[model samples]
Every structure is written in C-alpha cells, then in structure tokens.
Target: MSDLPLRSQLAVALGRTAAKMSRLAGKGDGSVIGGRIGLRLDPELLTRLAKDRKLVLVSATNGKTTTTRLITSAMTPLGEVATNAFGANMPTGHVSALASAPSAQYGVLECDEKYVPQVLRETGASLVALMNLSRDQMDRAAEIWQLAGKWRRALAESPGTHVIANCDDPLVTWGASTASGVIWVAAGQHWREDSWCCPECGGPLDRQEGEENSDWACRQCHFRRPTPQWALHGDHVVDPHGRQIPLGGIQLPGRANRSNAAIALAVVAQFGVPPEQALPLLAQVKSVAGRYTTVEHQGRTLRLLLSKNPAGWLEAFDVLQPAPGPVALAVNAQGPDGRDTSWLWDVDYRILRGRPVFVSGERRIDLAARLEAADVQFTVVDDFEQAVMSVPPGHLDVIANYTAFQDIRTRYGRVV
Candidate 1:
C-alpha cells in the first residue's frame, strides 16, 4: 500500500480511517462505508488494490456467502486470503476487502448476482465460479435469464478468465457456455421452477429423473447439461480422476453445503492444491456469517439458518433436525429483503407439517398465511426469543429471512 500511487495510497488510508470511525460509531464493520469513501476519492482504487493478487469471484443466489467462506478457508493454507467475509457483495465491499489486506496475495470475493459482471471486469479475476441462479429480490433485481445473459456477455469478453460453472442449472450453464475455458461441476439444483425453460432457446427443458447428476436438455436447441469434470454424488464429490472425496466431517449441514465444498475444492485445485490437502481446511469452517451457527441460549440449543428466498428456504429445510423437533421461522419485508413477501407462496411449508412450527417477525402474518394454506399448524409469537422459549428445552432450529435473521443475531450479541 505504501508503494501505491499517491492517490491510491491516500484512498486506502482514508478508507481505513473511515472504516475505523464506522466501527467506533456502531454503524457497521466499516466494509461498505469505508470502501464507498475510498472509491469516492480514487475511482480506480479497486483495480489498483486488486493488482498482483490472485482473485476468485463466487456468485450465486442461495450460497454465495457460504461458498465464498468455504473457498477462503480452502485457500488459506496456500497464503493469506483477503475476502469479504461479512456477506458484503458489492463493488464497495470489494474495494474494502482488497484495501484492508494490501499484502495478501490471494482474494476470494462473494459477489451479488447482478454485480458479477462489473466485479469481474474490474478485478480481472482468474477464476469466476457460477453456481445456481434463481428468483431472489425480484422487485429490485433482473430476471434470472437476464442476469445470466449479462454474465455470458461478460465471460465472453474476458476469454482469459477460467469459469467454474454449475451445469445442473440451465441459467448458469448458459451463462458460462460462452466462456473460453470452462470447468463444469455437476452441483445438484433442488429448485427447478426458475429454470423450467431452456436459457438458449425459448422452449421447455427436458429433465431426466434420477437420484444424482440428473440430465437436462433443451427440446428446441442443442444446449444441454455439459458433461462435468467434477460431480457431486451422495456424500462425496467425484473428482476428475473418478476419485470419491468424502465430504464427511464438514461442520456445515446438508447436501447444499456438500455441493459448496465440491466447488471450493475444485477452485483450490486450480492453484495445485489437492482435494486431500484442502479438505481438512474446508472442514474447519463451522458457519458463514452466522448462517448455520449454533448457539446455546436460555437453556436451549438454537441453530441459526438464513433463508431469504424460496431456493434458500428449501435448502434450509434440508438441514433441519428430524421431525417433531421444534422449528421457528421469521420473515421481514425490509429494503434489503426486497419488500415483497409474495415469494412466500413459492416455499413448500407442507414439509413442516409434522414438526412443531413457530412463526414470528414483521412479516409473520404473511408467513402464517402461507403455512395455513399448506395445512401446517404453527404458533405465532412476538419474536424469535419468545418462539424459542415456547418450544422444549432441548433443541430448536431457527430459519429467518434477511432482516429477521439479523435481528435474532443481534439479540445473541451479533455472531458474525
């Protein structure tokens, strides 16, 4: 940072100062505001700070934060990794991350779906991982296919950047199909309503029914799920050598996390790190941004999980404990949460029919209506703590949307 151009050095220094002030003021961790000030001072700060760093960008609707954290952990053994570990996925956050660790040789950034192209252009990332695309924040963001088209154009222009893409998702497959170099991964997509049609052709996609690595092809075009170099089988990720790397001991729960681990391992392998070498590091990650964090509060074990959209909620359901264990859900229609609760209907709440369910939040009424329609019985409480107290003393799982999740985290002393 000292050797940077005078303007860049000033920008970094001011950014750090502003971030410190932000932390002092209890505004935030200073990631966003600090970077915003730096970029205001030097428009090229992100590009300048990103120079000489080996960067990888991870973007997706459901698992961006988790996957980014996983990749960061897997790469830590190689060198110091500068990353946006707090779920800040914008350009400003990118600047803050790069500026904070000027000496770090590696970076793993979690990018928002819409900002992937811009971040890729600015950072010139060596590897950009494309995971599944789905409907999220629909009121504020572009359609899934439109976002994919932007990614396709961006990847096409950057022929030198290698792409690690999920082939099971038609939108993600179409996005990376135009890239010069692509490493396809057979990461399972549990939600299919968003990609019922072929991204390349305006026709229905023919999806083959199978247990793992199911095939999907367009009826109107030749575009289809590419033969993946790495595939996620049950409890393992199949490497290029047909070796089954067991995803055991990963503290994060569910097959979605296993898929995240597969992608992270595939990413580290590009830097010559073997899966065996990275697996232990990946297993060390217990949670990302408090998504799967388990905390003991009020004599009850509460596992916190975040589910901002239908795809996220489906994955959250997959990680819940066995039936009859009390589960609490909360939702809020805030600016960050897109201010639209209609997407609640897309979630299948019938899966909670047998579980003891509790609903609470600013939008708990909306969630309750959906639960009522699903024929699931749930009790509405004032907030997360009240819901937790209503359940038994042993264990309870909590799933909440953006603002609601943060509220609970705040009550627990902010577990980030």
Candidate 2:
C-alpha cells in the first residue's frame, strides 16, 4: 500500500510528461494523459483512501466544477481543503486529486453524475452536495432518472453523511430523500421557467406562483418544491438559523448562479466559517474559464459561454439579455463532450429571436440545419478565426460547446 502511493506519484508524473510530449508532438488534445491516468490509476487510488479522512463530494450535471471551486475557495479561510478543480469528477480523477493531497483536513471534490456512486463509496466523504440534475452529455449519462437511481442507492448506504441539494430539481430532490441532513438552496422565481414540468409525471409541476421568478413546485401531483432550508434572497443567502451571508457582486450571472452561490455558502457554513468572513471573499472569486468568461480581441469584447448540453445551452440563453451586436455560436462533435449532435434539439432555439448569429465548429453544419429548421437566421464558417473575424467589433456574445470552447480559448491565448 505504501508502494501504491509511490507508484501513483510516478504515474501522475509520467502522465504529465506524456501530456507535454503530446503538446510538443503537435497532437494536443489536452486530455490525453489525464484520460489515460484516470483509467489506469482509478482502482488503486480508490483502495488507498484512508477511512479517517473527512471527504466532501459535490456532484451534478452542471455547476459541479463551479460550486466545487466556490466551496473550496470559501473553505480555505477555515482550514485545509483538497479539491479536483479541472473537471475530473470520476473515480480516477477523485483518486488522482486525493493522491495529490494526502493529508488534507477536508477533501472538497467535484464528482460526475455517472461516477458519483463509486466516488461516494470509495472516498467515504463526510459531506455530499448534489447541486442539480439536468440533461447533459446524454450519450454518456443516459436518462436523468437512471443517474438519480444510482445516487439514491449510494446515499442510502451513507446515512451519516450531510447532503446539500437543490430543491428545484425533482431528480435531485427524489434522490436526496434518504440523506441524513439536507441543506436546500433555491433560486427565486426569475429563473424558474425551464423547471415547470415534473420529470417524473410529464405533468405540470406546482411552483410558488407569485411572480416570474424561479420559485418551483409540482402542480399536477403533490410533489412540491421544498422550501430551501437555506435560501438566497438576491445577494443575501440565509441559513436555516436565519443567519445572513451577504454576497456582493458575484463573479457569475443569472439565477442559476444564485443557486450555485447559495449552495457554496451553505457548504462553507457547514464547515463553521462565519457568514461575515466568507461572504466578503465571494466577490473576489471569478468564473471558471469558458463559463461566461470575457476576452478582448483587437478592440471588441467577446463573452464566452460554454454550452456543453441542452440544459446548459438553454440556461445560457435564458441568462443572456438581448445584445446589440451579432452573436457567435460554435458546436463540436468531439469525444467526452459527445459526438452526437442531436441533443441540440432539446435546447429552446426559439429563444434566438432573429438575432444575427454566426455558427462554426466541427458540427457547424448540424447547428446550421437545426437553426434553419427552427427558422433562425445564421451564417456558417468552418474556420474559428474567420468566424471571430466575421463578428463586428464592440461587445460580441459567443457561445461554444466543449471542444469549441477550448479552441476559442486557445486562439485567444487564454488556455492554462
């Protein structure tokens, strides 16, 4: 077991070396070594996690990385926290991250939906935060219900663990029913449009109907949205004890982010950090790269929105108010991000609203076809540079899928 750590260290070093070689060889996918290392070291890494270590696992289709980052960042003021920041949410990624920090006081890690069961079982985390379950990477993740089932079983076994859940998502609410203690955080009515229907009943879900804000409930059945044990009212997130954490000028936008911000506050609150101390640090935290990140090209500003799935694309569209200039969107058929381009249909393309959109990527044609079918106007470009060049100067909106996001970031020299 001692040698296992050394072997894992050697493997991680070799993986880094291989990644460098791949980049030098001009065959950089940026995921080659991480992928290989994840597949190989996962089993050995899981076996090595000591039961004494206190683990905090965060999972969801969207916002896992961002929420994990926020929670980890907020927790740092309290004590040592080990985390996987690079979207490595699977078993191997958890192992690699854990292996990297052998003696962390707390393991604050993000976990992928499909890998949550394995991570929970092996890592033995004291706290598990499930942000929300949405349709993402459908080809790999299957239905939302299937993922929920796995989580349900996993949570049943770990009855002692604390669970942080988004009450708006039915899948997460159902999955977290068995949790020992759940800290719920919900977005107000402004962002609740997409969640009106129950995923379970195909019937209208009852929402707290006051205004057009994001408040939620089940209409047809009695499965109503739970009033958050911890709730966010604009910039203030209130815990169950009525303690208020004033979040001023968060780095991310929209009500979706409010939900994430609330969860982050709740997670940090669980670690006993006073709301006053942690609330001040949130304004300093920045959005994860490619997720609403803005870049300057020549004299114009291009905002990058990483839309990896239908729910993500819809939410991105929801958050965006109509911009004055033309919008640029990119979609790709790459692995990990999925080669199947059909998931775009699930997005509310009608929201485009006759905006002049420039589409490009490996699946540019597919995007164009979908736009055409929806009667939305768009011009297609195969070259990303040409596509960016096509956008007129001054405040451009750009939305791109996974590979395209990396491509644009690389082109702009923003990749880490």
Tell me the spans in candidate 1 whose CA falls farther than 4 Å from its real position. none
Candidate 2 lDDT, 1-416, residue by residue in tens: 24456766666666556656766876653344553664475445554553567778888877788888778877887566777777767765665566556677678888878887877877677888887776677676668777887888888998778888877677788788777777777644333334556755768876555542345566666666677878777667777888776666676786667777788877787888766666667666676755777888887788887778776786688666475457788998888778778888766687785777888888888899889889888888878777677766777778888888888887886633
Q: After superposition, how far is residue 15 of candidate 2 from its true place, in Å?
A: 5.9
| C-alpha local distance difference test of each model | 0.90, 0.72
Clashing residue pairs in candidate 1 (N, C-alpha, C atoms within 3 angstroms) = none
For candidate 1, give the lDDT: 0.90
The reply for model 2, stretches above 4 Å from the true place, is 1-42, 188-204, 208-222, 319-321
Q: How does each model score on TM-score? A: 0.98, 0.87
Candidate 1 TM-score over all chains jointly? 0.98
What TM-score does model 2 achieve against the real structure?
0.87
